[model samples]
Target chain A: MPPDTTTVAPQSVAPSGAPASGRPADDLRTLESGLDALQAVPSTEKGSVRRILEGVLPPVLLLAGLVAVWQLYVVIARPRPDLVPGPLDVLGALGTAWADGRLQLAVLTSLERGGVGFLIAVAIGTPLGLLLAEWRPLRLALGPLLSGLQVLPSVAWVPAAIIWFGLSDATVYFVVLMGAVPSIANGLVSGIDQVPPQLRRVGTVLGAGRIQLATLVVLPAALPGYFSGLKQGWAFSWRSLMAAEIIAMGGTIGFGLGSMLQQSRELADLGSVLATILLILGVGILVELAVFAPIERRLLRRRGLTPGGIR
Target chain B: MSAAPAVLPAIRITALGKRFGADGPLVLDDVTLSIQPGEFVCLLGASGCGKSTLLNIIAGLDAPSTGTVTVASGSAAVMFQDAALFPWLTAGRNVELALKLRGVPRDKRRGKALELLDVVNLADAASKRPHELSGGMRQRVALARSLAQDRKVLLMDEPFAALDAITRDLLHEELERVWRETGRTIVFVTHNVREAARLGQRVLLMSSRPGRIANEWRLADDGPRRIESPEVSRLSIEITEQLRREIRRNAA
Candidate 1:
């Protein structure tokens, strides 16, 4: 970016105690100056493969090792092969189920229920949270209830949802809503609560009234909290959907992976049940990796909230 | 929009009294100050004194308990010790928020923001986030944002206290230059005696807790005086001794 520092005056204040060999955050002013001379290149685009290697490699290796040891223990204990299914047997069962198209449909159905429930949770929970945050009297009256609602298991809501909405998609959605919405709303409420009073004053002094302050300063600062809530809400929604599927009997809300696990259990097929469980766990991880993790990384990076030289 | 700007002193504090609460002791007591247009006044004191409290009152961020702080027209813009640059925005855009608030049209805000960024010699760092920049650079961006308000008065609360000596000194020069160029009345608050000496045209030194103006010094020497200038040194020592006496009296 710079061939010579002879005549060109450096602009902007240098970091404290920085020896600018032009290299920032290190010893050497000339290098720091060289670094300053060197224009900061835009960050490289993070590829899916690179992100996967970054995210999946460590956890995947650990989980694989755990499973391998567990499988070995089972093989040693129950040589009858009834209690122990080797790794290949589970993979082969997964293949066979996929070949039969049951696996895809079940996975797709679960995704749909989870996705719709999550979207609804965000829509309903965000506004409710904002309202609860803005209105002190209402928040005082209902805030404890909201917190209590989050702690109550989603499984607990299934019976009540079934009683109200019957055996239908609506019933499953209702259970998911009950399970997920409180966390999302509370996250926003707490996020709004934690917004610095100084920022609010800045907003107010700049001609912003109550609504604008909430929309501009209050909402953005609350984003870190909002994202965390969304992550937790999705976890709750997925779990709630599975619980709802298990409890509902009469009307077929369609077959999902949870139902397949139930079917495999009734048929006494341990290998198939175990395979279904792996698929559920794999999907859970993949969605977080594919969707939420990237966003979280980006937000953290923008704030310098993430440490450097960790790669 | 059509009314001509009011020509009164940029900020007028009449019989100002502020307390933490109704039952609490007065933090600032019956203080009356009138900041004329384009005047640069430094409120100097030790930590926990009411210098910051006074600046806040002038900015209208906090209300005075028993008095009115009236700005002739347009609200006062503030620069805090922390950059307070809203980490979410780029350096330029942080300044742009002020323009947006002042009712500058959306189309024109970017240009004005850039122009102000140029004023603080930070045009190169316009796109950088607050966290991306170093401490001194962050404060420069903050100074740019404060300038963008285009108000008659700018209230700064120890804006450079967190920075290092070199950066702080550099900013003092930049501030003096900006103060002259902008011709806006400035009420700068700081606990550092040298800093008060360096920047202030008239330095008002406050005593300890339940802070009040113990003495006011009128510096004959002009802008960017050395920290060790005879007049500046003499006044600073005199003020420091008085401040020390005040603190020691309380302790005894």
Candidate 2:
């Protein structure tokens, strides 16, 4: 590779006072601007309304179709109401729960636990990830174990958590941490690994010290990977919390969606159980659309990883 | 040129040698050179000629296995083949990072960054991200960031090799303008004969497999030269022939 050099030609007296170079200064500027215009990617983002419609309409239509299918199945086969509830029955059950405020309470309880547990996992995982990333020996010792933890079904931890913490918020949190921490830590490790050697070299050349390089360069570079880790961690946390809530329900633990579903199962009320399942799915979708999607889109757009502003 | 006070050489290398390990083959051997203040010197060589290693030694990124590198200014700023800008940062903020590292206060950093961007004729691109800019434009922003270091010497390692021919030509003009304006000593490493002939005031050719300076050319400061100019082409041909001979010698 040839090194690129920039130089200023010593001013020379050309006939008619024209600069003695490739082109006149004005012409060069025009050429440069023209080049930039031609090569630069144009913004391809659609209007906000269109983007929203595009995002929302398909899922909305799909959900409606799903309900229609369930209703049709009920109308055709005519299954008993208790054995397999129709879509309307599920909706009625959801309405009854909403009317009695049970739905709101269950949602709030589950969401609060999920949020707190995820935050704690992040707090713990971030430093652990950094430590593992920075220390080769430690990573060698523990990296495979961390990855293995991510694949282990978090539900498997519920019985152990219940035995250890005895049917309290501690058990729920313990399960959630076990599920989420490995994912967040793994995300950070991979993110750090992905930071280009060139960028780090650039930081060193710019006079960044060890700490500055890690904080300012390496960490920021690792963000996309770290962010994906957070998304995965949130999923794991929510899933683990639900599992723990269903299995270890008693003493200081208010009714969550998981508990409500378990109660409906015990009563053999298929409608309420179906309603609870829908609510859990809805909350997961809401968080993804409201929080993670927007952040990921912005990250990708800024890095030009998204082509034509479309992911 | 106006008469000026005597100045120390911007860079001096003494018997510099580099090898990967004790038993490894030498990458650079017995390399010695001195560059005057405000000089534009190009290290021209083939792929494995250790020109980049020699540069790394001067930039202090790599230690010499033997001998010494004395840079008068105590610091040098470097640019690479890729712009190597932080992707998360806008072009201006990328430059500002260098200024910030130099301890420029937050209040003053933006203004200084913009000033350097203006030097590279990229002031309008300050807010654009590196990926959003064209290859040529990205390199210009990189130039701005290097300039933001406020160092007396700028080391470039094939900064425009990835650009198109027309863009590379334009950047050559831009770089010449900057070098003249900033009066900074520059050590540019390149494998391209014409690029060396077109840019550097002095061109030093390095031989590969225990790289050593094989020959040198001091191009006369004739009125603005272009890559296509007869003088540059003639010199490039001469240098290319010498470079080929050096390669053949290694084979023999």
Best by DockQ: 2
Name the lDDT of candidate 1: 0.78
Top-scoring candidate (lDDT): 2
TM-score of model 2 relative to the true fold? 0.94
RMSD in Å for model 2: 4.9
lDDT of each: 0.78, 0.88
Q: Across residues B8-115, which tens digit of lDDT does each residue of candidate 2 receive?
A: 789999999999989899999999899999999999999899999999889989999999999999989999999999999999999999999999999999999988
lDDT of 1 by residue, A72-116 (tens): 877677654546677777888899999999999999999999999
Q: Candidate 2: which stretches are off by over 4 Å?
A: A1-27, A307-311, B1-6
* Residue ranges of candidate 1 with Cα displaced over 4 Å: A1-52, A63-78, A307-311, B1-7, B221-223
Q: Would you estimate the TM-scores of all the predictions?
A: 0.88, 0.94
Error of 2 at B8 (Å): 1.6
Computed on C-alpha atoms, the DockQ of candidate 2 is 0.42
Residue B249 local lDDT, model 1: 65
